[model samples]
Target: MKKKKLLLTTALVGTMAFGATIPTSLAHDALGSDVNKGEERIVFSNEDLKTLESSLLKGRKNVGNFYEAAAVQIQELEGVQNNTADVYAHNGYAYLGTHTANGGNGGVRVFDLKDPSNPVEIAVFAHDVPYTWQEKVIVKSVNTPHFKGDLAAVSVQQTSRNNSSRPDSVGGVLLYDVTDPTDPQKLGFYQLDRRITGTHELYLTTQGNRALVLASSPYADYYTHGENEDFQIIDVSDPSNPEKLWGSDPRELEEISEKFNGYHWDAPDGHTRPVFNHSVITDNNGQYAYVSMWDLGTVIFDIQDPENPVYLGRTEYRDDQKGAAHSAALARGGNILIETREVSNPVGDGYEDAYGYTRILDIKDKTNPVLLSEFTTELTYDIPETSQGRTTFAKTVHDPKVHGNTLYLSYYSGGVIMVDITNPNNPTEIGRYTPESANVWGVFVDRNYVLASDMGQGLKVLARGNKVVNNGKGR
Candidate 1:
């Protein structure tokens, strides 16, 4: 076991100040400067943990009342573990990813959703990955020449930044042949370079006869010492032979530096914000990609040719607004884009005392995305002035999933917020569900039911109608 100490201060303490915990093996080191010098490892000190505990306590106080409109929780499954990270619903099943909490070894859990209200855990995949955790899992149906049927892609990240040099460490994408939900067969793994940790987020889609995966490697340049790119496109037509098609480096893009050069308020205490791809998603046709570059805004690229990506444009933030361009989803015939900003620091220099919210953008013109409207919950805007400076994991918006004209947002402590995106310009909250203690990480809207992954809780199945069919017993 090895330990890496981080000398974190105000600026360096963004989302890391939340509930992110490192393994005991990786203890805190106080040998460096007050600010992080691009070290990949994320370790917190006792003081930081105290701050998190205090923040969570204060945040729960403001969790508000339990409310639901046009939606009801039909089923809930406290997963095999407590650190569930994300969930993806497909066909008649749900795949849940886990984080590196409690222990470093965490994997994906698959559930049978035949009975929407009574999901049963059928199989668990990739739990054998040593010293690793999975944050994103996406399963897509492929009909390419090399493969056909349901394919699952799970992102594996090493628990410690320095663990990449160890032989038993796992850091990459693990593919699985989950055509059979009850029994998933291991297909292949697309391991990241040693210098790079692993894929934080990814989007799997099919283009023509080829199946492609757009993997976002956050801060890859800093970890790899500027030798690798942050965004990678891989051709997984054959699950057993996943090949890299191309990579996109945000630092090379002139627009990135040009648009965010003078944005100091969003930067860490005394440091400049680093530009890198935090997450990515493609259009329905898989011809274009929207890469969420933190502080750089959501960058758009033409990926018709997987090998060559053409830069189009990106969304911008006002000088006073904190930019964390976290994750995004397209809606309304691909004309409307919903971008969620994950501002971990509620009150900071030159910024308001508020958590991140959803930003509605009109991307009808690929060259320029115009901000249509901004949506924020009462918790995001009304945090107590007493708890303004602390980091609260409960308030910020994490992920968004759109179905038809509705936007299902997984808001941390705010729970799952259902918004009417029929009119992107004037977005209105049509419904919301906040558990007694909610920490929603990812959300997915399938058919008539919605699946939300809560970090503290587990798999939550909610539907629009009042009568949710429950044939079997809870697992």
Candidate 2:
């Protein structure tokens, strides 16, 4: 267990924004319970309600100095309920994905970003069913198997907080012809069987005339089933027709499951040994797929042969430290792997448990990799006791994006933290923006601006330019 800690500040909670905090009775849980359930749905029982009653706390009070307030938030696209999970931007359009919420149906929100500051809500792709649980969408130009100019893929998780109310809900991926950003056509629907849980996140790629999809099935692992259910691959070259290509080897999955059967998790309740794929990413060439396997560390696979993947290697974690391995990004021509860990609980003065941080690994030699350094910001909390307040400075990483030498991370309650990874061995926090009620889920860095999806707010476009002085100049 090599613990590589960088020079990090244990103070400065970041820019402070004052807002009205919702009461516990009116506040809802984040993504719901993570208890025993094959469908990974949110089930708020009497006990859950009782817990929520006692979890009401105050809002954020202090601000950190390290926070530059440099990343100026230019625009905020509000959704029905604002459970935005991921954002995918194309030529001039931004596709925003949403999770199920109280007053909204989970669906895809498309905006014409022809104007960055003032985006127009041109179209929306949502299911007509009573219960909808869409978490992510990917839009890209393609000349694949069926010659579809532009395509969009959306994920529908079959689980829900109230399972009985979503009887007709099913889990799978939905394909659409988005050649026209304003009007998307339903191309196909690739639904999965009940044997496995719904797809949580998908890694999509295109080569020549073929499109590949590697889905991250969260709860359906080898231990739960007799086969490898975590990393299932599918070929959707033909937009109208999709096919399941292959999945990770069951034998390999079984081996790892047995090895980590006694692995300790970071659950606030107790130690729970479980393995699941939180997300996966492929290199530009689509030669390999890196999986963020929770508690199992990061797993690598050679996917040059999309039909048959070969296990390459994986990173090891200390027994004393729990592995939350949530998401990752590749940098320096895929030589370095930057991974983020998802923390389920809260930390700081009022919380009971702590969480993991961002890690930089030197994978120039995939077989024999080295941990370069680890980065984490100072954790601060306003009301650490309640459900809403506990997330304050819940310094957990949800997703990350790498542009050249800079790494952009969506740090849940920690807001967004940008690190200068020019020197991978000494990654330092360059800039950060923590909204008063920040619960950022995804972040993507573009040419000029960075797009982040917040669980409470929709799409936010931020610029990493000049800092904000008492009376700062635009230039």
Candidate 3:
């Protein structure tokens, strides 16, 4: 197995995070896990939580360099949670997410960020599911492999603890024609209903004229079913009327039932049906797809040919043996895949034992993906050590986002951790932010800004500082 080293600092521990301006008073605020009124809701607050979240962007000399003080708070949204960011601009583009209760047609929402700070909701789309459904979407454009303008895809979360609409499958992907953001049309939708699965996070691959939708179906849409969840690859070339040309195949791997994370991961008596699929990030060219294959770790696929997604290799998130990879992103350039290791449920497992973390995998070898480095912070005593705050107990790092050469993460209770991965081998935590009440669920970043999808706080846009406007011209 080959390894990619983080050209930057090996590891920057106990570092002070750039202040995203969450008032020193609310500075200890967390990103997610907030109970609004009575029900648990993900909120991004600007009240007293200043927008400018600027902290020093660190790295090992030749590794990487990010802005320090230019950060500013731009906007905040109420419902979206997790890394459902669609920042690539096209037309009057912005960001999109699967928000609200997580299921139903209302699960989908979009923001118009033509104005960076004040993001406006353009549209929403979703179909009913066993629970509340959430979503992720991207509009097609040139430069993209398929480059079919006006086309886009969204992965819907059809089930959650909030609802009983348990899906025959977790959920499905909906194709849309968003030429007119004000009035978007649902072109098509397809479900991988083999088990009660949720298409957590997925991406559209440029195949031919039609894009192939590669989605991950998460098991346990409600609370008792994740053990049997798995993944499926669908062919939605015909958006208006998509088809499941693939999937329904044997779960390449079997899920072993063990007292791992503690959660009552069903099938305790024996190995439950494997829950495959999850995070799927692509190379710069969109030629290949790197997926966070849940218990399978990070799997690299040779998608040079999208339709026949040839599986090249797989990595074990738990180890050559234990835990699991919940979400992953291609980092350290296209050759490496960054995997977020975790378990959906932890019954009585010790917090430290849960050991959720991030791993860097070398995917250049294809058939033999290699692990480079891993990082984890000490969990707070209050963070949930059980089920990932589905709608209850909270805490744990859920998603990691890569921008430039640095990686920004949303830690459930650990707060926001920024790592410098100039060298994949040794990642450094340049800074971190953990507000007292924040239960961070997901994160998204652009050129120089980071946004934490806080369940109770709204959308916290962090930047260096309010861009200081200079008045002196001829100083």
Candidate 4:
């Protein structure tokens, strides 16, 4: 990987755009973080988009406690040439994924973070496959059968609703050799049939020498194919040649659907939707894979044997309950599971009173899962929720990540929230950062900084202010 030289120019403040120079003069204390104090390439520039600047100015005026100027705003990266989605930092490099924005192509942007304040973009990766929408990227080192070194996995989703429209429309996972951050070599591209909705979200784990990728195909379901799609697991032991290890049993669709009230269907876009897998994660030891099925609750799959996966147990929700089982993470030594729902559809009361928060499930027993509690931010009550098709960005819980006793979440427009889940029964919000023009898609709390990807803006680098206990978890 090669590093790029840093440049400096004047910036207007929270503006959005692709690739530009920002001077140190724009670095103000009001933004909450300390500027590097020298000529450097600021990751973000306000001069690019005046709207973003206005939003930041407004956000600063009425900042809340959790978001109150505690964390330092290290850097902001806008005009990255793509709409940022999920973000991952590894080996001094930040791999930022992209979403399908305005029919633009999706890919990943690699930034050299050796100099956090002056991060530089060294590479952009996109596959040559058709209907290829790369939204998420996961990187890890693999010592598999024939592969050993740094490997990156990215998701490929449907380019259009109908895969047949593009005969070569392929959707699945793409593996890459990212040993060198500047260059990502394609290892393998996995594709499912046109009938299935491609990979939406996924997770990667290493067991022994083989690498496993748990892919979430959220569009494949019983109503469409007469069977719900099981999250797929692939063995990338051989980076050049990947093989399907196992998948959820389609036969168990009706059984699980019945448990989740037979799939909560709502297609405001006029397209009849089906049940699907949204996210998949495994325990640290690779023993259990927690799969979150939208509207179907969470399903536990025993993956002790890489080649074989067995159904363990699942969570149950009620009809009157507001549920959108979207994604989850394991914590407390895999004894506790933190699940997040992705919905803001109004119920009887109206969008203003919609419910979409994080749920804590107890998986102490593999056979029976129990819901322990739920966590929500004050912003949920302050923001006005709207219908699914409407702009409910800041009203819903997008994702949750646990590091020690703290829970870092990315709320669409709510910015990034930090919660203290020390007590499983009572999760409290200790800190939060909601940008004025917030439209946060994903968040990752790194060793030295908190990384957030905003759909409307771009990447935000923040420091957990002195108010945070630091408890040595973020390291």
The lDDT per prediction is 0.67, 0.61, 0.50, 0.62
lDDT for each residue of candidate 3 in 330-449, tens digit (9 for 90 to 100): 765577777776533333222233435678878777667777987656652334535445322244456778876778777765556788888889988776655545555667776545
Q: State candidate 1's TM-score.
A: 0.79
Tens-digit lDDT string for candidate 1 (301-356):
88887777777788877756767788999997788889998775576555556788
* Model 4: CA > 4 A from native: 1-46, 49-80, 163-165, 222-228, 253-274, 348-353, 379-391, 464-475
Instruction: Give candidate 1's root-mean-square deviation (CA, Å).
Output: 10.8
Clashes of 1: 3
Q: Give per-residue CA lDDT, model 4, range 211-296, as digits (tens).
A: 88988876454323433344778888886787886666433433422222112333222222234577888888778888886655
Worst 10 residues of 3 by lDDT: 28-37
Candidate 1 positional error at 120, Å: 0.5
How many pairs of residues in model 3 come into backbone collision? Answer: 68
RMSD of each: 10.8, 12.0, 11.7, 14.6
